[model samples]
Target: MSTIDPTGVTLVIGATGTTGSRTVAQLTAAGRPVRAASRRAGPLPGAEPVRFDWYDPAGFDAAVTGADRVYLVPPVGDPDPAAVMLPFLDRARAAGVRRAVLLSSSAIAEGGPAVGRVHRALPGLFDEWAVLRPSWFMQNFTGTHAHADSIRADGAVLTAAGAGRVGFVDADDIAAVAVRALTDDRAPNADLVLTGPQALSHDDIAAILTDVTGRPVVHHHLTYEAQRDRLAAVIPPEFAAMLAGMDRDIAGGSEDRTTDTVRRLTGRPPHGFRAVAERELGAPAASAAAVHPESPTGAGSGGRLR
Candidate 1:
């Protein structure tokens, strides 16, 4: 739908992820060809699935072939995504790829965190590039993460972000923005902060879940050390500490903000926390949680808060 040929394949990295899957669906529905790249590429609804891994260079050429655009998901756990992505980006540029969209977190800045490094370098690598700095995904509450299990089993949501609010955005909304970023004739060429329509505290979230699920849900506020210790059982200690630190920052109201970028870019409003809760929790607990990846927040992300 851009100036580029409509038939030119768009390489979608992490094609089966939270946002990636939705992006692929939207693009394909619009009659665009897509190369859905992932570690275990399988049959998708309307695209070609191809095996691709960021750490593997040998798989890059096949995925990039005849592709004019790409959606990037930086390698998690890698301190420098640029090291892993820059080479492939150069290769894509040489192969006539014209646009790129990188998925980043709102908490990460242009020169700050791991994705931030990639965000700073996006423009220079490709003339048309947009960085999506989305806030913590609402999926963290419904999907396979530290919160979902406890929420399902104990009817409780735990966080160190006591009373601190977050403008949790929906993954589907993020995907719609990605589709535009990859297909629009003119790129925004800037870092866009994506959020839900409103901000809500963890307590508000628990209340919403309780109302929607008709279950007695409670918000269990944990100390920073306790949050870190709980996560340490699953992920690395250093990473758990890092997540706890971010949670502490949240307690200070770090993520209590909303934006209109989603509506401005996608011609639709982002999903509110209430809407997310109703739709996700409106279903049976097991069914709703099954909609997410096995582990939406392990490591290599901002924190389990994501």
Candidate 2:
């Protein structure tokens, strides 16, 4: 397998976020130089913090400067992020950035939606490029996302997905694939559809959470319009509609498939939902009885795509 030069630095956008943070950590742990970009530019172990904001282009040049490769995470909650993202990407390309790896959703496709437009433009901007179309992140239910908030407050997971199943993937696995795509001697040069080992319904997720946390978590189904309205309360109405439509599509079996992309790329099996729960939620080893004494969980509620 051909490899890219490991001497160049990598700029990680959204460095404080779920996948971005992990990507930065992994890159740095591998003895690679990383410029971690975020609004606050907060400190991360083994990374150089750089202040960056998509809406503000003043810092864009500095963020891309000295970096040869970049990991892209579009600004969250913006209905049309391409408007701002495209300009910065052009700047990065001109500033000597060569490789780019974008974090996109499995529900979206090239030229399909928000980040999809970016996915379509990536190849034209950089000769070395990859788009990581990862399934809904398992971090959504563990981090500060709406699903996790509701679970902590009311012990319920809300969604319009009904009984449909999704191949929920862990954010760590997404980051692992991203690191490979960025640093590998060869750029993926293609969109990678990432998913965990198996498909799981929301009920299975709730049961896993209930067992792990010992808090009796449950899935609370809602109508499409209701889900949209609920999400609109916090995010833009258009973005909220888009998110609810994903749920509607889920109910139609759109996200029911799984992929071996993670294992194929990372050289190991992806983590299961139960395993993610046990690790992220601090579940004891005894709580592994939730899934027939065997298995192992991403998104089920209103949250920004990260």
Candidate 3:
């Protein structure tokens, strides 16, 4: 791990998402100079917010101007982001950015699957680079999945992974580690697989919710085909297929391990699922449960390559 000077500005791409927003907040709170890049231009507290779009390569150079480090996150819908990201990394390198920290997934390692192709190609693009391989996020329970609605209405959670467990990490933990990689010189160059301290299946999560909220919550296990059919009614066919494929992987025991990388990088154990649910959901869990009906449940597992 090369220790580049940490004084120069760090640019944050995808500065509005769950992890990106938190990264920006943490970096700025630590008194580090930061430049937040997004498609929209606005004033972000404690950082310089600029207009940038991954679809428009013309905006790339300007976004990284005067920055020493960059946090690279790909756009959400690009089936193959490496094609778009490689050229941008080339630009950042030419523009004199010293280090880059990529937000990657545990599912897609250096040639594992769809997004893995991009992961495989990342190391060769920068002198100092670190890939964050994190498992499913704990946010889906309270933020953006149908599970949130299920928790709100029927007091249940749903998944296709019958007994598969996941070491679901908090997005905040991922962001904290990203901030360290962006600013500190001690982070490793190789892929970092981060996970929560413990692995919990959907049933375990449902039990936690039941305990914390004082409501009867249950985990509804569905077949991959059934889950796919349920999601197909609301999402695009391709996206639904991708989701179903992940469920298949989980059911097959692909994501049933834990890692200490979170603690190694950030000097703290990754937050537990219940802690995250409570922090994000808050007391009077009923009021929190009432907020979102369709909260996502199985994020943190990045989408698979088709």
Give per-model TM-scores: 0.90, 0.93, 0.88
RMSD of each: 3.3, 4.7, 3.4
Q: Which ten residues in a row have the lowest lDDT in candidate 2?
A: 289-298
> Which prediction has more favorable lDDT, 2 or 3?
2
Better of 1 and 2 by lDDT: 2
Misplaced by over 4 Å in model 3 are 1-3, 285-306
- Please list the C-alpha lDDT of all candidates, in the order they appear: 0.81, 0.86, 0.77
lDDT of 3 at 39: 89
Expressed as tens digits, the lDDT of each residue in 73-128 for candidate 2 is 99888778899999999999999898999988899999998889999999999899
- Which pairs clash in model 3? 114-305, 144-295, 144-296, 145-294, 145-295, 145-296, 146-295, 149-293
Q: Candidate 3, residues 67-175: lDDT per residue as tens digits? A: 8889887776455777788888888888888788888777666876545766777677777778888887776666644466556657877678888888888889989
Reference-based TM-score, model 1 = 0.90
Q: What order do you get sorting by lDDT, best first? A: 2, 1, 3
Clashes of each: 1, 5, 8
TM-score (C-alpha, index-matched) for candidate 2: 0.93
